[model samples]
Structure formats: C-alpha cells, structure tokens
Target: MAALRQMQTEFNNVANRLVAQWRLEDGDAWAVIVAAAVAMLLWLTPHA
Candidate 1:
C-alpha cells in the first residue's frame, strides 16, 4: 500500500511538472493523454 501511494505521488508530481513545462490547458492535457492511449492500443493490436 505504501509503495503504491509513493508511486502515485511520484506520478502526480511528474505529471504536474510536465503540464507546467508544456503550458498545456486542462483539455489539451486530456486530449494528449487520450491520443497516446489510443495510439498505444492500436500499436498493440494484432493484425488480422
């Protein structure tokens, strides 16, 4: 539990830093995240 909490905290800190550095608006950050997730899913999907 403690390890998970620490990792979550670290992730939050890094995300905050990235958002500030990139000067991204809230919607832009979410859009970037969703786009990355979709790209990753497409990349991992097996070709038929």
Candidate 2:
C-alpha cells in the first residue's frame, strides 16, 4: 500500500527529470544519426 505509493512517486520524479534532460539536448541530429547507423548496420549485417 504505502510502499506502492512511494515507488510510484519516485518513478514519476525520475521520469520527469529524464524528460527534462532529454528536452534540453539537441535531438534532431542525434535522431537522424541514430537512424542512419541503424540502417547501415541492418544493411551490412547478414540476415539471421
């Protein structure tokens, strides 16, 4: 009961901080680079 509530609050606080940090960073170029890397890896790797 009380433990569950405490866990939920802590989770919310951690999630909010992560969201704030993510929002503060430059995400556009990072997203494009990540996508390109993933595509390259997929293209180069043998089918499994």
Worst 10 residues of 2 by lDDT: 39-48
lDDT of 1 by residue, 1-48 (tens): 676567557766766666776674778876775676576557646631
Q: Over the full model, what C-alpha lDDT does candidate 2 score relative to the true structure? A: 0.59
Listed in order, each prediction's TM-score against the native is 0.52, 0.49
| Count of steric clashes across candidates, in order | 0, 0
Highest lDDT among the candidates is held by which one?
Answer: 1
**Model 2 reaches what TM-score against the true structure?**
0.49
RMSD of 1: 6.8
Estimate the TM-score for candidate 1: 0.52
Alpha carbon lDDT of each predicted model:
0.64, 0.59
lDDT of 1 at 47: 38
